[model samples]
Target: MRHFRISFLVTFILMAVSGWWGYSHGGMPGLINALWITGVLGVMEVSLSFDNAVVNASVLRHWNEFWQKLFLTVGILVAVFGMRLLFPLVIVSVATGLGLVDVWTMATTTPDVYAKHLTDNHAQVAAFGGAFLLLVFLNFLFDDEKELHWLGWAEEKVNALGTESLAVLITMGAVAACVAMGPVEEKYSVLASGIVGIAVYIGVNWISGLLEEGEPDLQDDEEEGAAPAKNGNGDLVKTVARGSIGGFLYLEVLDASFSFDGVIGAFAITNDVVIIMLGLAIGAMFVRSMTVFLVHKGTLDEFVYLEHGAHYAIGILALIMLASVKYHIPEWFTGLSGVAFILVSLWSSLRYRKRHAAQA
Candidate 1:
């Protein structure tokens, strides 16, 4: 509840604004309808993003207080306004060659046209986002250093083949296959976008690694009387130096990838960009709050398999996004798939805990 206090406050404020916006547009009936739709959209975003919160927590727990505070403050603004509101507009502007003002007009005055333009470019969007998320999942899946096996024999088998470059090779292969099977017109665009996605992932990690080089070695810090913190793999946590620029960039890009599905799917429920932003913003805030809660509570340390479940869900989401390039995947199915993975993983964690306790 303490972690969620600000989230609840923001929700109330947004809902009130939503009501006013609705009333001004259409009166009492509009107010009621606006509240209802906003609630639904908020729930949809939260449901679709539970795995996102878990994954975010996994990264955030390693960060210092200053960076964590920055994440909650500045990062939330980026997630809500930058990703949810402005990102779609930017995409539409680039795709349609419309100026920002004209695009804004189109979004507000002629929402259907705006949505069509945005959805028209879905193939490229899906390709880019899918490629990045695929790499994220693959990197986690093939990490031989990760000792905990969530899926038992299956995980062990995958871990056996783990190597630093394996994830990249697999992702590149996936992109190539998609390009070959895709429409001839979109082949070049898909390939280019997928490559860019991979490049961004590698670049961010490389830069972050460079930044981390300046920090004191984990073993040295432990000997100096700093309490040692071990991660899920039992490796000593490295000190985050001077604001962790790499981790910040990685988190932002990851949020953008997750936002792709929600932003595009919102058009199905309503074409009004204002209502969509308001609703999605509420949901995005809650996701950030959930991330903070998980970090502060040390929930990940307790539930070892939660991170495994989140990465697995991310993998499924990456596949779904790629598949959606050619087929219509229901939004309900997308949200439900993620929830199912999280629930199963949580159950596995609970069982592992009980078994370990009994053995002790």
Candidate 2:
């Protein structure tokens, strides 16, 4: 509650301003409609992204204050403006060979045409976003080092394979199938986009791993109650220099991958770009604030399996996005499915705690 005071107040002000702006643009009825749409979209984003918040908190709990603050500030800006606003235009501009300025003008002056162009290339966007997210899900599933298992025997067997690249193999096969099923003209572009997605995920992880490798073991610092005066490799860098930056970048890229669908789906609600921006902005802010709440409240420590649930949801979402290239699925279904997974995982965690207490 204390952590979210500022966010709640800001949320109120933003909603009011959003409503008034809606009224100014669309008159009294439009005012009412705009406010309704914004609120709904905000709720939709929160529902769809509660798993995102949990995953974010899992990453954030490891960071020091500076990195956490950077996530709230810089990361939120990227989620809102960078992915929400600018990313859409970038996708349209690249697809249509239009200048950025021209795309912006089209979005404002001729929204329907802009939307057609946007939706026209949904397959490529889905392929890219889906490929990146599939890798995220697969990597977690195939992690030989992950000790906790929700599906004990199956997970154990999968983990036992111990091969570092099996996840990538499966993901590559999935991408190839999707590409093959796509139109002949789109095969090359689709395959290339997916490869780019895989490459970006690999590149980001490699860079982050390289940076983190130089940092001393965190458990050592916890035992000593001090950051190392010197890092493991005898580098001059401060302890914060390595892990924090790498972790921040990793989380931001993860968030960007998570957000790709939400941003694309926002157009279904309304064609007015400003309304969509404000609506999504409101949701993005709430997610940031919710993450802080989770970290400060130690929710992850209490609800141990919550992170597992979130990842499972990510896996499901990845499959859905891949399947969407062949079949249309509603955004509501995606949001609802994610919420259902989180709820079931929460129940499982509570049951585990109760049984452990009885044994004690």
Candidate 3:
């Protein structure tokens, strides 16, 4: 309850704003409709992003207090305003050769046209986001040093072949396949965007690695009464105090990737830019709060396979995004797939705990 206090507050404020906006446009009926849509959109965003929160917790658990607070405060601002509002406007501006103000006017005054312009460029967006997310999934899958395996047979084989190069190769192959099979006109854009995504992932990681080079390794500092560090699999492991900038940048980019699809999908529900932003903003707030809750509660440590499930969901989502570049995959399917993985992994974790307890 305490962890979610802020989220609930934000929800109320946003809903009120949404209701007022609706009333101004269409009186009582409009207000009712606006509130309904806003609530639905908020739920949609939350459903689509639950895995994002879990993955965020996995990385955020390692950060110190200052960075965590920054994530909740500054990071939420970026996720809400940056991604939800400005990002769509920016895309429209670039795609249509309009100024920011012009794009904003178009979005507010003639939302359908704004949505069309944005949707028309969906292929490039999908390619870049899908490629980046694919790399994220592959990196997690190919971690050779990973101790626990959720699906041992498959994971062990892949982990044995773990190499950064292999992950890149697979990602490149996926992009190439999409390019070759996609619309002839879209091939170039998809290919170029895919490469850019790969480069962005590599560049961000390289910079993060460089920044972390001199940090004190916390792995060897295990002392009496000191809490042991835990991996995503909930296994005790060596840890390090990482440079905050790299982690911060990594998380921001990750949030952007996760949001690309949601922003685009929001059009299907409503073309009202104000509603879209407010609804998604509410969802983003909850995600940040959920991440904080997970970190404070040590939920990841307890759930064990939750991270694995999230990464697996990410992989599925990446594939779906890439596939959607050429096909019209429904957004509901994407959201439900992730939730399914989390639930199954959660059940598995409970069973594992029970078995271990019996053995003890």
Candidate 4:
């Protein structure tokens, strides 16, 4: 109860600050709309990002107090800057060869037109992102470890390009090339953007795995750094340690991957970039909070298969993204469908818990 109160107060403060800022710039009506839009976007983002929380909890459980703070503090900055500011710019740069300042002007001035143009061409983006996520989802289904042979193969072939960092750098270069030459040189090559997105995802995962191996094992230092105290039997208490900052960052990257479609799709409904950001940011915040809530409460243990459902949702979303790359499904339809899947999965979790309790 105490935690929940603090969470609500924090959320309120942040939203209020955002409202004041928006109001100062755009007047009362603008502030109200910003509140309403960001509010709505926040709800949608939470729902859409539920799976993200589940995934994050799994990774964050291992982190120590220091890195955990860093995860929240630094992670928030990364999300705001990387997703809110730079991401849209990246999309614009890829779509049109415009400078960042010019893109910002266009995004703010004629946001509706910018949104519509992006929405109109969403199929390609969806297809690419969808395909990549699908591959990730399928890999989870088939392989337990989810290793990236691509990077490993590169390590063998090219001495300099073999490093994990180099692999990602090169992959980004390829993505830029694909975005540039692939579409312009050959009209059919527009599909290359999503391919690049997939390649990037792979690179990121490989890099994360490589970096995660560097962290000290938690069990080794558990005696010196146990959590505050356990209320009940130790079974329910998670051993806290500084886990992988890289792991959480990787999760954020995946969350961004999931966001690509939603961000573009949101534009189809309305063109206000501010509205889009407001809504999406709000949604993302809720999701992040929910993730922390679940972690703190050990909700995953309560609902054993909740994580599975989320991964499945990720799979479905990935497919939707891929389809969007080439097709024109209604934006609302994509969001609602994922929502439905998650609901069904949640229900299953409840049922599973009930059955187990009855047997016990």
Return the candidate ranking by lDDT, descending: 1, 3, 2, 4
Preferred candidate (lDDT higher): 1 or 4: 1
The residue-by-residue lDDT of candidate 3 on 1-360, one tens digit each, is: 899999999999999999999999999999999999999888999999999999899989988776788899999999999988888789889989999999999999999999999998888888898999999999999987788789978888888888999999999999998788789988999899999999999998887787677554555555445575455533211122353577777788889988878998889999999999999999899999999899999998898899999999999999998888889999999999999999999998898889888999
- Lowest lDDT sum, 10 consecutive residues, model 4, at 233-242
Stretches of model 2 off by over 4 angstroms after superposition: 216-240
Per-residue lDDT tens digits of candidate 2, residues 261-289? Answer: 78768888888877787888888888889
Least accurate stretch of 10 residues (summed lDDT) in model 3? 232-241
Off by over 4 Å in 1: 216-243
How close is every model to the real structure, measured as TM-score?
0.93, 0.92, 0.92, 0.73
Alpha-carbon lDDT, every model: 0.89, 0.81, 0.88, 0.62
Better of 1 and 2 by lDDT: 1
RMSD of 3: 5.6
Better of 3 and 4 by TM-score: 3
Give all candidate RMSDs, comma-separated: 4.8, 3.1, 5.6, 9.1
Specify the highest-TM-score model's number.
Answer: 1
Tens-digit lDDT track for model 4 on 178-293?
34433354324444655566666677677667655654554765867866445653322232213543466567677767676667656654566766775676566556666677
